[model samples]
Target: MAHTPELSPSQPSGSLHRMTAPALQPTETGTGTRQTQLLARMLLTPAVALLFIWMIVPLALTIYFSLLRYNLLDSESAQFVGFENFRYFLTDPAFLASLQNTLVLVGSVLGLTILLGIPLALLLDQPVIGRNIVRLMVIAPFFVMPTVSALIWKNLLMHPVSGLFAWIAKLFGAPPIDWFNDIPLFAIILIVSWQWLPFATLILLTALQSLDEEQKEAAEMDGAGALSTFIYITLPHLARPITVVILIETIFLLTVFAEIFVTTGGGPGLQTTNIAFLIYSQALIQYDVGGASAGGLVAVVIANIVAFFLVRIVGRNLEA
Candidate 1:
């Protein structure tokens, strides 16, 4: 300044002082951020890798096989057919029938499960003695293997001559019905529902338990009847869980095979045949790999469509 009073060597010029030493390296924060990113990637890698492998491998194989006229019985005869199998399946009467049966089976089970599950959940939510024991009993069916459940219903509960149904019919002086023959689809539906009802009940019951009791009390204070409070408050709270249950159950129901396989084998006349059973029959019994792969792809498409709508509906409800 005025001959800038001789600045000490220790005092730098203003420009030199203003110039920052390449910002002191934030070693700790930088290292921590890098380490955190690495740890997250390491943790997520396995699941991502597994899903990638699982999806890509089978899906690639299915697509490849769908284009070829492959037969399990005669590999040498394999040739590229490119959508012929899909065309055949689309036009096949048996395939169409199986699709119908699949829809019916899924619809029937879904309707019955929701109807029964909501009530069962409501009852289980009550402060009754041994409620936990009852809840366990209700969920027991879901724990049973599908094949075992089907067998139990077929042999012990629905068998015409010696089953419980027969015994009960006899007691009432009524004829024993051949459930598998007269209403084969209905029999399969019942078995599937019995197995899935427990799942629905468990989910809905958990949702019911988490409901806000203060809301119920407030409604009660407002002179709302029990029915009115449940309809307005409890039902709204349960809608999400119910949607989840239905979506998950539909996925399982669409691929239902073991119960139908063990119970009626998709017969008396393909009356209970579903897409899964149809795919099995095409691949194994007929040894038609191409057809089976096409059917499998179709099934996957239908399932995805249903899932898409269900997810969208549930997401909208959640946002609301």
Candidate 2:
């Protein structure tokens, strides 16, 4: 064995202390905070810069095109026409009809989903056999492609002559109802609600599962009725999740294209054309790029307005 080196009084006694002393000593708090902040900013810079570019480029292009008298049919005649495109797009007779249809479609679907989702979520939350299978079945519709779902509804379910609904009606001595022909907007709403119902149910169920069991137990122990417990405890717990669902669903619903496309084709007349379909018609059908861009900007503004109100609701719920 090698002889151990003798410690010197003038130097540190132990290698461990020599190694760890500097590290273990308190760092300057201000210096550490500044270092942490700098590192965070450096890490965040790339993501922030990427997001900025992504949002800014499209917005800038849209603004630029919206101000021009650009048409795919007459590309050589393109000229800057400060808001003339916007004025024309807004003043179009189809604009009012499409706006009304959009409002109706969005409102009806939101109401139906929320009304149906809560009961479904509560039902699924209870103890039952094959609960997992039931949940998977319920959620399966949301995973189906929008176009496929629309076609399924159109041909298999809502078809006046040869559909399941028609068969059901015939069985009960009732005449088959032509869903799209009689109630086109409602038919669209029904299909959209079916597709979105699963999403709302999943979100609400998760919220239900996260509920504090002890509070529920306490409520029961205090002689609270089922309705009372739900009204007070369950409903309050669900407020935030409901707001989240509404916000997310509204954003997607604002741009619903596929279902309308595959089913009604935006009409028997212009009856089913929402703002999105109107914009599509302007750009692709009518070959008016400037008009479409202006319509797109209007859509953005409407979405932002709705989002602002929904955010306020969510914020209040969070605070409470």
Name the candidate that leads on lDDT.
Answer: 2
Give Cα distance to truth, residue 143, candidate 1, Å.
Answer: 0.5
Let me know the TM-score candidate 2 reaches against the reference structure: 0.85
Reference-based TM-score, model 1: 0.88
Query: Each model's C-alpha lDDT?
Result: 0.88, 0.91
Choose the strongest candidate by TM-score.
Answer: 1
Residue by residue across 230-278, what tens digits does model 2's lDDT show? 9999999999899889888999999999999888888978889999999
lDDT of 1 by residue, 82-159 (tens): 999999999999999999998898999999999999999999999989987887889999999988999999999999
Every model's TM-score:
0.88, 0.85
lDDT of 1: 0.88
Task: Please list the residue runs of candidate 1 whose C-alpha ends up more than 4 Å from where it truly belongs after superposition.
Answer: 1-25, 309-320
